[model samples]
Target: MKSKKILVWFRNDLRLHDNEMLVEAIAKSDDILPVYIFDPRNFQLTPQYTYRSGVIRAKFLLDSIADLRKSFQRLGGNLLVLTGYPEEILPVLVERYDIAEVYHHREVAHEETKVSADVEDCLWKLRINLRHFIGHTLYNKEDLPFPIKDIPDGFAQFKKKTERDAIVKACFLTPEVIAFVAIEEWGDLPAVEEIVSAEAMIGEVHQELIGGEEEGLKHLNALLEEGSTIYQKSTVKGATGKSGFSSRLSAWLALGCLSPRMVYWLVKDAEETFGTNPHFSQILLGLLWRDYFRFMFKKHGQHFFNDYAMKPERLFSEDREKLLFEEWKNGTTGNEYVDNYMAELNTSGFIPHAARLLLSTYLIYVLKIDWIKGAAYFEEKSIDYAPANNWCNWAIVAGGGKNTGTIKSAFDLDKQFKLLNLVVYKQ
Candidate 1:
C-alpha cells in the first residue's frame, strides 16, 4: 500500500485547532503539504470600483497567513505560500508533490463556491481527490432538524428551531505531533505592501486591531472575561451614542482564526464553574445570527448580487447621485455619527454594531442610494466581510431580506467614494 500525501489548503480557516480538514489530513496521511494561497480575487475591486477586501483586511490577512505558517512550523511542517487563483496553483502543486488528495473547508457563498468548484475540476483531471469539511457554521448542516435549503425564513424561527434541535459540536483538539515530508523552498508570506497599495489605506489604523489566531484567541478570552464591550450593549444604547462595542471577536472569526465552537465551549465551561452569565447567552445568540446569514446565502443563491427585491428600478446612472455616493463611502456625509463610523471602517476595517445600523440606514434611506451600494462598500472594507452576512444585512435594511423587518431611521457626502443594518448584523 502506498502512503498518502494530502495537501491542506488554508483559506479563511487559518487556525491549527478546531480545523476539521487539518485534523482529517493529519489523521489520514503520513505526509502533508499545507498551503496558503493569497487569492487576487479577495484584493480586487467590485463592480462599484470599491475594493472587495480593503487594505485593512489585506493587512490583517497577511498577519494571519504569517501566523499560520509559524503554527505549521511549530508542528514540524512548513506552509507553502503562493499568489494566484487556487484553480491554477493547486494543480501545479498536485503535480509537483504527487499529492493524492486535497483537503479544505467548504464555502457556500456563490463566488467562493465557484472558486472551490473550479479547483475541484482542476484536481479531478489529475485523478486527485478534493475533500471538503463543513467548518464555517456553528451547527453543521447535516445536524439541522430541517435541510439547509429549508432553513426558516426568519432568524427568530431559525434560532428557536436550532436551539431545540441542533448542537454545536466540541472544538477539535490539536494533534500532539504532526508528520511532515521535506519540501524545500517554502514560500514567504506576503508583506502588507505586497498585498495592497499604500494610498488605498491612507488613514491611521487602530493600534488594537491586529490579526492572526493568537490575537483572536486573546480577544476571545477578553470577551468571555468581561461583558460590556461593543457586542454586549443593547442596539438602542449603541445607536443612540450611549455605548461602544467590545466587538465580539469579529475580525478573527471573519478570517477563520477563531472558531465559534471554541467560544461556545469556553462559555459553557465558565457556566460550569463560575455560575451562568446571561452575557454568554447574548453572545452565543449573536453566533446563531451568523449561522442564519450563512445558511440564508445557501438557501438563496446569487440573489444578493443585485439591488435585491428585484423590483422595477433604474440604475443610479446620474452623475450627481454617483458623486454623492462617493462621499458616503468616504465618511464625509456631514452626519457626525455616520462619519465617525465610516471613518473607522475605512481606516480600521472595524465597524461596531451601532455604527453598522446607523450607517446602513443613513446610506439607504437618507442618501437614497441603493442597498447594493452599501453592501458592496462593506464587502470591500470590512475585515469581517462574508457575502451572506454583508448582503443579508443590507437586504434587511432595504426591506427585502428573508424576514428582517423594515428598519426605520433618519440618516452623507464624501471625499467622493464610500459605502447595513437596523439589527446587530452579527458576523
Candidate 2:
C-alpha cells in the first residue's frame, strides 16, 4: 500500500511540544511535510510611516522559521518555506505532492480566520481535507461553560465561570521520531530584508531577540525559578515606562513559541515547591487576560476595528488627531516618559505591559487620539503583537472596547504620572 502524505501548516502555533496538529498529522499519516508559508499579505505596510510587521518581529520570525526548519531537519523532515498566498500555494502543493490531508491551528482573529477559510475553500475544491485544532488558548472553547456566541461580555464573569475548577490538560509528549517523506524540495528560510524592506521600519532599530522553541523554553524556565521576582515587582508597579519587571514571556506566548499550558503548569509547580504568594496569580491573570481577548475577538468579529464606539463625544478633531497620532507614533509627544518608552519600543519592538498601558492611556485619553490608531501602531511594531489582544485591550482602555460601558471620561493621567514619576511632554 502506498504511504499517506499530509502537510502540517505552521502559523502562530510554531513549536513542536504540545502541538495538536503536528501530533495528529503524524498519527494519521504515514509521512508528513512540515510547511511554513510566509504569506505576502503579512509583510504589508501602512500609509508611509507604519509597517504591519516591524523589523524586530520580522527578524524574530525569520529566526523562528530557521529554528523550526533546523528541528525538522534533525528529525528527518522538510519544513518547506514558501512566499505567496497560502490558499494558492497549498493547493499547488496538494496537486504536486499528492497530499491526502492538511492540518492547522484555528486563528480566531478576523484576518487570520479569513486566510484559514480561504485555504480551506481551495483545499475543498480538490477534495482535500484541511483539519483544524485548537492550540492557541490555554483552555479549549469546547470546554467553556458557554458557547462563543454566549460568552460573557464582562471579563470578570468570564474568568470566574471558566477558572472555577480550571483543569488544563497535560502537555503532549513530542514523538521521538518523525517519519518524513522522500522530498528534495526543502525550501530555505529568507533574510529579514527579503520580507519587510528598509523603508518599512518606522522607528529607531530595536534589539533583536533570538526566537524559536529552544529560546522560548529557556525564557520560560528562567521565570519558573523561585528567585525570579517578576511577579512581586510587577504587581505594585504602574507604567514606570519600562519593561523587565514582568514575566517577559509575552513575545514567546504571543508567537505560540511557548505553550500557555506549559507556562501555567511550570508556575503552578513553582508555587508548590516555593511558598505561594498573591503575586503568583499575577502571571496567571495576564494569561487569563490573553485568553479573554482572544475569546472576545471570536465573539465580536468586525466590531473591534471601530473607533470609540462606546463614547462618540470624546474624540479628537480629524486635523488635531492626525497631528497627535503622528507625534505619538514617532515618540515625540514630549511626554519624556512616553517618548522614552516609545523610543524603546520603536528601537527594539518591545515594551513592558505597564508601560504599554501608560502609553496607550496617554495616546487614547490624554491626546484624545483614536484607540484604533494606537492599536494599529502596536500591531505594526510589537514583537509580541497579537490582533485580539492588541486591539481589544486598547478598546477596553479607551472606554470603548469589549464591555467597559460605564467608563465615560479620561483615564487618571495624573495618578499614572505620579506612580511612574513621569511628566507630560512640554514644547
| Candidate with best TM-score | 2
**Tens-digit lDDT string for candidate 2 (137-244):** 888888888898988877778789989945678888766789986778777688888889677754557465678888989877776674455442333234643433
**168-253 in candidate 1: lDDT tens per residue?**
88889976688875788998777777777555666667634778899888877776666433334423343643553344576788
Name the Cα RMSD for model 1. Answer: 5.1
Candidate 2 matches the true fold with a TM-score of: 0.91
Global lDDT of model 1: 0.75
- lDDT for position 202 in model 1: 66
